[model samples]
Target: MNTTEIFLLAMLLIFTAPYLVWRFCKTDYFAPLVIVQIIGGIVLGPGVLGAAFPDYYQFVFTAPVVQSLNGIAWWGVMLFVMLAGMELDLKKVWQYRRESATTAGFALGVPLLFGCAAAMLLLGYQGWMGVKGKNWQFLLGIGMACAVTALPVLVLLMEKLDILRQPMGQRLLRYASLDDVAIWGVLAIILLDWERMGRQAGFLLAFAVLTPLFRRLMARLGEDDRWYVSLIWLALCGFGADWAGLHFMVGAFLAGVVMDAHWFEQRKLDMLFKHVLLVLMPVFFLSTGLRTKWDAGSYPVFFVAGLLLLASVGGKLAGAHLAGKMLKWKQGEASIIGWLLQTKGLIEIIFANILLDKQIITSDMFTALLLMAAASTMLTVPVVQPRLHRESHAGLMQQASS
Candidate 1:
């Protein structure tokens, strides 16, 4: 088949397989379509489908087809990350400064420590760290990956649980948003190449100067014009970041961070986010899968995946529990909040992809992190549902008595 036909076939698999599993299998209660799509990518990756049917895998995912898919994935993730940055409400965090800081700090800090310890163990071995990665870079990268919470996915899960408009939901969003900013900041630090220090410094300096001007221009534009302008801005920032030895994704986030979400209509922004997820992000997931490997060592991929999951989930819960103690949150709130905050959905995968691209973490590490992310995400709904239900029921009874 021609490359175009082959690419279409690859896309066909990407869209159809995940949809069937998510729709017919009714996995949405436990695993959302995004999580399912991620799992589908792993299933279709070289490690799984390729291992089982190398001939078919090679035939379908030819180099040209893979390259074609990659183009879509790159732009898709850039848009998605930008939207996530726009959704950040630093203003809200400021309003609840004390509570937000306490929660966000412990939530990010504890898991980061735990993940660092885990990375320490991995560092003792060969094949886990990337070619260009220093020990500190690998350690910090893995640690930050554990500390990540997918703010976008958290919003979806909260909406699914019908807590999206609630005070608790708002509180969770604040914590996740704060952590999201920190995650990217830490990534920029990790990606800092002393060799390219001059370029990186110039990019930051230019970004600082251009940000206000860009915001001013965006402010003056109509909503229709803003959308077009934002895309052009996204492209330029992405190019600039990549040229500066930082990843384009970092540029994408910076582009979004400076803009006000209030500038765009909420419904339109939400639709754009949804469309990006539905249409484009799946390709990113598949591309992520294409990069998965299991050649780390004698240890199996699932075993490594499990260890990372323990570190990530355990650290998150530990952090939340600490916050609950500090903030005097009621009983049962910690468990629910901790589980929800531990969700490492799209953002975790994105972070892992960056680590792989920067050669900070090996492909096996990426695969392990991917599994950790999917498992962590899937666990969120199941674990939180009962606690949420009990809380709701209790609230109703209390209200009735009052």
Candidate 2:
């Protein structure tokens, strides 16, 4: 009917469609609700649903409605990124510097190189690179996309595996956290606009000067006040970064990393994540899906998706196994760690979105990356659960023999 009614109807689909499939189909073991939501978004996007039912799709996903949804998605993801940043334990990462460095380095570097190779393969084809994107930027953007591990998603999967509070889980977080920092750093490099380099420099300088003062202010406030102030700060940093030619998510992350996690109540922080995912992130997924396209042809796009997936999984495993060899880890340890770190969920999509915004990657490339990320995430639990069980059984056998 009206725009308001249409927007409400769109929101209905965003929340309900995925939940029904996820719950009724019992896809939890392999495909979590988040995975279902992402797949649903793709299915509901212009390329699929709109192509199939143009009038119905256009009616529901009108310009104003899509814009509203995008605004919500932007804030939702920014807040999500902030939470991820707040979870970083730089102090602990430094404590185990050598081990963390080796593991994180291999985990990120090897996959990065593989992803670059994959990018090189795509260069021969048309419709993959964004017009505004330089050859090196496209390569590095694709490379980093493969190397990402969604720290928030990793925490959830580890919790599901009952390993989140374990020593190994802590180790995994350390490694992911370090990689998380590097991921954003690489993104900044990719998003660098030469014409706006001066503005970007000023943004960083201002950020460094402001961060400590902001931290001190946060420390002095009551928890309730801190939350409100943090939101305000999040908005301002996002604006500042966008103005400086960097993405707003970078600013949102800076807002979080500067604040001590201890400044907020742990239970509140948990609720923050829970509520954000439940209430907000689905819209982001839907918006991401709307941007997906088959411009590179379905076959080539899917083929590229397959290639990226292979590089992502293979490189992560190779890197992890190499780390295990150097550190003398137990049998089957690398398998579990490698599979777990291969996860690339919301963060990868967000990374690809940023690239798309700057015209680094075309819609087809975005779609392929989206597929690669969703498939990688969906594979994590199924693959790792069996490996964990097998590893445990072998450990028991060795103990009995002893």
Task: For candidate 2, give the lDDT.
Answer: 0.93
lDDT per model, in order? 0.93, 0.93
lDDT of 1 by residue, 264-330 (tens): 9999999999999999999999999999987424366678788889999999999999999999998
Q: Report the C-alpha lDDT of model 2 over 192-275, residue by residue, as the tens digit.
A: 889999999999999999888888898889999999999999998999999999999989888888888898899999999999
Distance from true location, Cα of 203 in model 2, Å: 0.7
Q: Against the true structure, what is each candidate's TM-score? A: 0.98, 0.98
Clashes of 2: 0
Candidate 1 regions off by >4 Å?
A: 295-299
For candidate 1, give the lDDT of residue 310. Answer: 93
